[model samples]
Target chain A: MNSSGVRSVARIVARDDGRGGTALPVLESDGPLALRRTRGSGAEARVMLVGAMSGPLGGDHFTVRARVEEGARLSVGSAAATIALPGQAKGEARYDVRLDVADHAELHWTPEQLISAKGSDLHVTTRVDLAPASRLLLREEQVLGRAGEEPGRLTSRLTVRVAERVVLDQELACGPGAPGGWDGPAVLAGHRTVGQLVVVRPEFGADPVTARVLGEGASVVPLAGPAALVTAVAPDALRLRRLLDEALTSLL
Target chain B: MSRAALLVLADGRFPAGGHAHSGGAEAAVKAGRISGAASLADFCRGRLHTAGLVAAGLAAAAALGTDPVALDRAADARTPSPALRLAARKLGRQLLRAARATWPSAELDALGREFPKGAHQPVVLGLAARAAGLGPVDAAYCAAYENVSGPATATVRLLSLDPFDATAVLARLAPEVDRVVDRAVEAARQAVDGGVDALPAASAPLLEIGAEAHAAWPVRLFAS
Candidate 1:
């Protein structure tokens, strides 16, 4: 890894102790990234991720691989927001995430916002593989550029599979003049920040209150095979986060 | 292969139920991203390279005799929004009815039987093209052209901006559209051996997001 670049890798796997106690996460990390484990009083364990540096910049690649074993549960979060800064060479920053949930396991990953500064480009690729009976709740939020500045390019590709079958495959490319490009009505309709929430569970029942909370310009679409997707856009990250949290809370 | 079959499939009036949706152009127009012919052309270009390319590739692959069920699942993966999925299936069912009547075949009938509600529109288009004895490239061209043409024609009604200008917008995009079809066909060839994973999955979130938003509009003119 370059001095200015941060190449971090961490994997958290939960294992049942064969007793009534909750399974703990096996944590590992390198570089400027820190992984902190929090004891779960209820039915799941918690893990907090923190970075010594600001965030991944140009030419920086950050990766996280996480899994939840059978009969185990875990929740992952970030210490603070991730700020992507412009690098010296103008290259794009990359975040690659891989997650797997075994049978009868659950994993909820709610990370902080990822803000891309001006002249910065960010690409995130997330692949999730789950067992037929596993459950997952994933939330990702992105804010393009700072206030009063031209937004940077951010492309996100997500693929979700259950029992080796593709459940959802999504690719989002946003920049100048892109569809849902900046200020476009059909896409974001001029919203600077966009957030997404995905939930897949066995008994994920219906909730009419969720749609009412999304209000204008936000939508909650229930996918086939016990999955629900929500996307919202707002003028700022705070507003978008609030809307996303509201919808997610209702679903939860 | 009857060459005229390509034209028949490519005609905008095939009654495939495409006229009801603006291809997300209505939201863009309402947001002021599509004010005139120039902006509309730009939007079409972006869509052509992204969603259009992906749709064309799927259509081409289906035309090459790829598994329709597998392609349908791949289409589901590529499409994240439920509203878009519903629209694609509706159009697929509608296209199946038309294709079965126009060019009766066992394959089309089986597909209809398999997916009574519907499959993705591109997959059905590919199967229809195959039933008509057309090649993957022809199917790709049809899907690619529809990607931009649907929105262009819809904008003509939304903005009432000169119909000539909208047609001209498509005319200028003809070269780019051909390029997209070429890429789609090439990807389809790879998909023949590499499986559905080889097909393009490039997506436009705004389209997915727009599809969802548009679906909620109780007062919208388009079905999607």
Candidate 2:
């Protein structure tokens, strides 16, 4: 089913609740954050952030900003993959995630995979600004199609800026007539799902053993003593999720 | 060709832009993971076994005019880290630019078109070797030499090691390079005989981590 023209945004704050469950921090936006429930209910949760909504959108001309204040530990989860339906004109999704963590503040921004349906094109930019002693564990996963189906042709680009420097830049173009691309044993290993996790911690070890353990199908590369890049590839979206979760658990 | 040409092409000072990279050594060093030459040598050997061997095998196949896209994909799949992929592409582009100007041919041009902006180094070098009339053994040797010498030279520059001592280290690595090349040539031959898909897959997780860490550094000189 084609779900188009649906747009909404929701912001959630994470605070230590003195108990195990996190408390929602106070949001300081000029307007209220947008939230909407789809007319039909299914096993999956589909959320869209559009213009006039509180969050980011695919077609907005201006950049959207998200602020995470100090001592706030926010965990943002998506109901499911957000699809970029074909736009009448070229469309783009831009997000500037400004995370202002106080000393020992933790943030986990794990969203669902971004699915670009057939004929859909999108460009997404996510920036994370972290303060010293702030910790962040973020994951970006993308699936080209739905279950039991070959992914439709699409073009998607993701650029992540951490502390004002480009840490991750990826562009995928897959269509019926696109030029030479990822159809080989070495590139994807015939895997359809891929995920990247970036962890910024001050206590990480300098040895290759820790990095090795963190990397499975992914490459574990060190970026100083406090940062690391972990990547993985799997046959499906679920496998990718499981692998990343395991890797992160092992790291902790 | 003279052995000097082999030395020149494989030399750390060839200006192919390899010396600038530690082949993931900088990250390892920054992480305090590698402290001495022996540990550094061990890191180099691991890289040789994983990235080096796979790349050399792919280069040999590309030299025989295999699809550049396929070879590039194979290399990319093996390289899971985006940092390493970018590094390989940067080095590949520079190497191809120089090789095309120095030695131009139809096959090289074809491979260049297939690669366009983001070909990996091993694939380009393999194609360049074929264009330059070099055989599989020579191509494999060049691949192994570039892999080891890049890091050795980087270690010298990063640590300020004596040039004479660096040369001696390179000298010591020559036999290892030959051994790797021999194994790679055999693998290439077997893959060609058995089919490309029949080629083996190997990996060294530690190097992958080093590459990832290097990419995340706030300030770093090396690309990978």
Report the number of the highest-TM-score candidate.
Answer: 1
Q: Write the per-residue lDDT of candidate 1 for residues B138-215, one digit (tens) a residue.
A: 999999899999999999999998999999989998888888888889989998999887787777656776776677
Candidate 2 wrong stretches, greater than 4 Å: A1-252, B1-5
DockQ of all predictions against the true structure, Cα-based: 0.44, 0.05
Worst 10 residues of 1 chain B by lDDT: B204-213
Which residue pairs collide, candidate 1? none
Quick one: best lDDT, which candidate? 1
Error of 1 at B93 (Å): 1.5
lDDT of 2 by residue, B1-224 (tens): 45554554565565667766878767666655445565556556656655677777778777766677766766765565656778889888888887788678887677667777759898888887877777677778888776766766777777776667666766866666777777778877776767554333444444565576567668887776
- Fraction of native contacts in model 2? 0.03
TM-score of each: 0.89, 0.50
Per-residue accuracy of model 1 over A1-252 as CA lDDT, tens digit each: 354565678777787656744465478876756788876757788888887777678878889988888888889999888877777644688989999999988899899988877777788998999898899999988888778777777888888887788877777677763433234434454678888888888665343223332565467766655677777878898898888878877777
